[model samples]
Target chain A: EAAVTQSPRNKVAVTGGKVTLSCNQTNNHNNMYWYRQDTGHGLRLIHYSYGAGSTEKGDIPDGYKASRPSQENFSLILELATPSQTSVYFCASGDVGGRAEQFFGPGTRLTVL
Target chain B: EQQVQQSPASLVLQEAENAELQCSFSIFTNQVQWFYQRPGGRLVSLLYNPSGTKQSGRLTSTTVIKERRSSLHISSSQITDSGTYLCAMGRNSNNRIFFGDGTQLVVKP
Candidate 1:
């Protein structure tokens, strides 16, 4: 089975703090994505990377940045966390094309106070 | 705008009964997938049926590319099957996939 693991399964940070969520996939998939899920909005794409050193903004990219330093790792960074950023975040990896299935990590729950 | 839409935002089923979920896309797409997420759990891919019909275990998924719609049929639903089912649509040109709000299912014994 494809494996995607995320660090700090749960986190709590104060407002204006910096938070970094990391994701690693052993599937070696070429595409990785970051998404945040909320009650009303469902899952909105925050950022995605085609490969190492490449990142693209998704539908909701404000107050968020992404880094893909290697094929196995992708990270979502919130330079200034806010109470509104408190949500469950998911990371997924997939094949080069959009036709393939995406494998999602366990998820990270962020709480900003 | 929500490009992907799922019907019956929520559902309640008795054990051993069957459940049917529907998904529709506003834009043309050849990439359609079904995902499942348990309460307070991660998302898992259930089916990747771009077109035609496909089955795995007690789950069946049918996609009609021309109609721009898909359906997931869960036979003999169990309590373990209770979860939020999400449908995602992708385009051939880009790697981005759009997601629906999801259909939350609850199974009662």
Candidate 2:
């Protein structure tokens, strides 16, 4: 089975604090993505990486940053957390080609106080 | 601009009943994918059909690429199938998937 894991499944932080959400995938897929889900809005893409050391901004990338240190690991960084950023974050891995499927991680619930 | 929109924001059905969910997109997308999410759970890929129709078990999905629309049909719906159904589309080479708000389904016993 294609497996994707995320760390700090739940967290609570103060405003202006730094928060880092980590994800690791064992599927050996070439693509990784970060998304946040909020009420009323659908899952919005924050950032994605094609390969190691390569990252690209998605539609809602304004408040987030992504790092792909290796093919199996991807991270989402929130340098200055805010109350508005509190939400459930999901990490997914996929094959980079057009016909490939993406597998999602269990997701992390973060709350900024 | 590219966008994916789902219809009937929510639905309630009795077990053994059939349910149909609709999705439409602005502009032509290169690919379409359907996902299911349980309350406080992860998003699971239910189907990926760029065009035409495909079936797996009790779920069937059809995507009309040229018409920029897709539909997911669930036959004999069960309580276990209750969840939010999401429709997403991929445009251009970026591989970014735009998603709809999802249709929340509740299946009564």
Candidate 3:
């Protein structure tokens, strides 16, 4: 099975602080994604990357930026965190095609106070 | 407008009972996937049935691309099955997946 891991599984930050969540996958998948999960919204995509150094905005990309520095590492950056940004973030890695099954990391829960 | 919709926002079931979940898409899609998330845990892919029927263990997923709908049936529910079930559809144009609000399931012992 594919292995995906996220750092700082639980986080607490003051408002206006910078928060960065990191993800690493060992499956060597070409596509990686970042998403935030809320109560009613389910999972909203923030950003995704096709490969290293390529980033594309997803349905909900505002207030979040993504970086794919390498094939195995993808990161989600919150430059200026706010109270409303407190939510659970997930990282996923998938193969090249649309029908490919995605493998997700454990998830990172961020609390902005 | 929501691209994907899931029925029964929440459901409570007794142990040994069967649970059925439904998912419908508003747009044309041939890629459908089912996921399960334990309470405060990671999202785990259960089935990737874009079309036809597939089964794994106690979970069975059937997808009808032409009808733009899919269903997941869980037989003999257990207390460990309590969590959220999410359905997602993939867009071929942009390679983006849209998720439904999910069906929260609670199983009673």
Candidate 4:
């Protein structure tokens, strides 16, 4: 199985506080993505990395940053968290091409208070 | 604008009943993937149907490239099958992924 794991399955952060969510995958894939899921809106892409040392903004990348320091690790950063940022974040990894299906992580539940 | 759209935002069914989920792309797409999301959990890839028909377990997916649409048929659904079904479309030759809002399913015993 392609395993994608996330850290701090649950988190609570103060407004304007810094928050970081980490993900690790053993799939050895080249593409990784960060998505936030909210009610009514469903899941929206926040950021994605094509490979190490590269990151691209998704449809909704405001107030979010991504880091791909290595092929196995990807992180989503929030420099100034707000109540509106409270939601579940998911990380996914896939093969080099879009034809391959992405394997998603367990997801991190973030609550910005 | 939502590039990928799914019909019947929610569904409720009884055990052993069948369910059909639909997905359509706003524009042309070369790759289509279906996923299952448990309540407050991760997504599991159900079928990666680009075109034609594919089956896995009690699930069957069909995609028609010319029509730019896909459907998932669930036969004899169980309570464990209750979850949200998501559809993702990838632009032709490009890897950009677009997601649908998903169809929530609830199965009652």
By lDDT rank, best first, the candidates go 1, 3, 4, 2
Residue-level lDDT tens digits of model 1 in B47-97: 999999999999999999999999999999999998899999888776678
Q: Considering every candidate listed, which one attains the maximal TM-score?
A: 1
User: Residues A1-113, candidate 4, lDDT per residue (tens digit)?
Assistant: 57999998999999999999999999888889999999888888899988999999998999999999999999999999999999999999987645656889999999999
The DockQ of each candidate is: 0.70, 0.60, 0.67, 0.67
RMSD, model 3, all Cα superposed? 1.2
Per-residue accuracy of model 2 over A1-113 as CA lDDT, tens digit each: 47999999999999999999999999899889999999877688899999999999987898788999999999999999999999999999887667546789999999999
Give lDDT tens digits, candidate 1, residues A1-113.
57999998999999999999999999889999999998887888899999999999998999999999999999999999999999999999988645656889999999999
For residue A81, give model 3's deviation from the true position in Å: 1.6
Off by over 4 Å in 2: none
Cα-based lDDT at residue B59, candidate 1: 96
TM of each candidate vs. truth: 0.97, 0.95, 0.96, 0.96
Quote the chain B TM-score of every prediction.
0.97, 0.96, 0.97, 0.96
Cα lDDT for residue B36, model 1? 97
- The sequence of per-residue lDDT tens digits that candidate 2 reaches over residues B4-108 is 889889999999999999999987875888999998899999998888999989999999988999999999999999999999888657667778889999999
In order, how many clashes per candidate? Answer: 0, 0, 0, 0
TM-score of 1: 0.97
For model 3, the stretches where C-alpha displacement exceeds 4 angstroms are none
Worst 10 residues of 4 chain A by lDDT: A94-103
Residue B101 lDDT in model 2? 85
Error of 2 at B98 (Å): 0.7
Better of 3 and 4 by lDDT: 3
**Candidate that beats the other on DockQ, 2 or 4, i.e. the better one:** 4
